[model samples]
Target: MRWQKSDVDKYVSAKEYIDTLIIPLIDFQMDQDLENNAFQNEVLTILSNELEKELTGRIMLAPSYYYIKTFDKDQEIVRLNHWVENVKKQPFKHIFLLSFDPAWKKSEQALDASFVWIPKIQSGDIGSKEMQHTIREQVKQIGELIRSYW
Candidate 1:
């Protein structure tokens, strides 16, 4: 289930069964290399969306939390926890933060949600067959990982 109007309507009565929340943490720098960063952003977003699809109706995908590449990690944690607190009102028992940013790996222990940091992919054509195959494999692995927490 996504955080969309129709999905939320279904969730209103079935919230108890939808126990997990997936929040994507996106990091990007908009400098002269905007195109590269844009590719990275799209790839990461697709990856997160695929994860959401793998377990639809069991998870809610929150809006992606985009942060400037240079933001202070501690300050961001405080802000992220604020979002988590609000979601907890829906009574989600398991929360996971998905990111390709390496910084989150270091502070994973301090976070309220389980943090899964995937290594960043080198920029490439996501439409290519090879890229699609790789993405599918990675998404399968991530789905298994998320299910492990249940």
Candidate 2:
């Protein structure tokens, strides 16, 4: 299920069976690395969508959690935890935070949910067949990892 009206409706109807939530953490920064950051977001979005599709009824795909790139990870953790706390009111038992930003790895222990850091694709033509294949493989691996937690 995605973060859309119809999906949420389905999720509400089957809330008991859907025990997992996936929150994509997106980093947006205006700097010389803007292009790379944008690329990462695009790839991560593709991966998230693919992962959701692969695990349809068992997981709810939350809206992408966007944050400005900053050195203050503690502040971001607090904000992220707030989101987690709110969502925890629901019945979700497994909450996964997905990101391509390597910085999250350093603070994973402080996160309220499981943090998955995907390796960033430095540069690529997202529409290319090779890229699509890569994304598909990644989605499979991530889907398997998530299922392992179940």
Candidate 3:
């Protein structure tokens, strides 16, 4: 399920079956690397959407948690934990934080949820067949990983 009214209605009716939540950590900062950041955001969004479809009944894809790229890790971690704590009130048994940012890998241990960092695709035509294939494979692997935690 996704963060949409229709999905939320379904989720409310079947909340017990949907025990997992996937929150995409999106980075936004205007700088020289703007294009790369945008690309990563697009890819991550696609990955999150596809993953939601692949594991529809078991997981809910929360709205992306956007953060400035240059934010301090300590402060960000505290903020993110607070967000997770609130989300936990919904009875989510497993919360996954998905991102393409390498920085999160360094602070994974400090996070309140599972931190999944997928390597960023430097540049690409996201609409191309090659990209679609890659994304499908990624979703498959990620789905397996999520199921492993079950």
Model 3 Cα lDDT, one tens digit per residue, 20-124: 999999999999988888889899999999999999999999999999988898899999999899889999999999998889999999999999988777789
Q: In model 1, what lDDT does residue 84 have? A: 91
Worst 10 residues of 1 by lDDT: 116-125
Off by over 4 Å in 1: none
Top-lDDT candidate index: 3
Residue pairs with backbone atoms closer than 3 Å in model 1 (clashes): 1-57
Which lDDT tens digits does candidate 1 get at residues 14-112?
977899999989887888888878888898889888888888879989999989888799999999999999998889999999888888888887789
* Residue 25 error, candidate 1, Å: 0.4
How many pairs of residues in model 1 come into backbone collision?
1
lDDT of 2 by residue, 1-150 (tens): 999899999988898999999999999989998888889999999999999999998999999999998859899999999999999889789999999888989989999999998888889999999999999999999999999999
In terms of lDDT, the poorest run of 10 residues in model 3 is 115-124
| Alpha-carbon lDDT, every model | 0.87, 0.92, 0.93
TM-score of decoy 1: 0.95
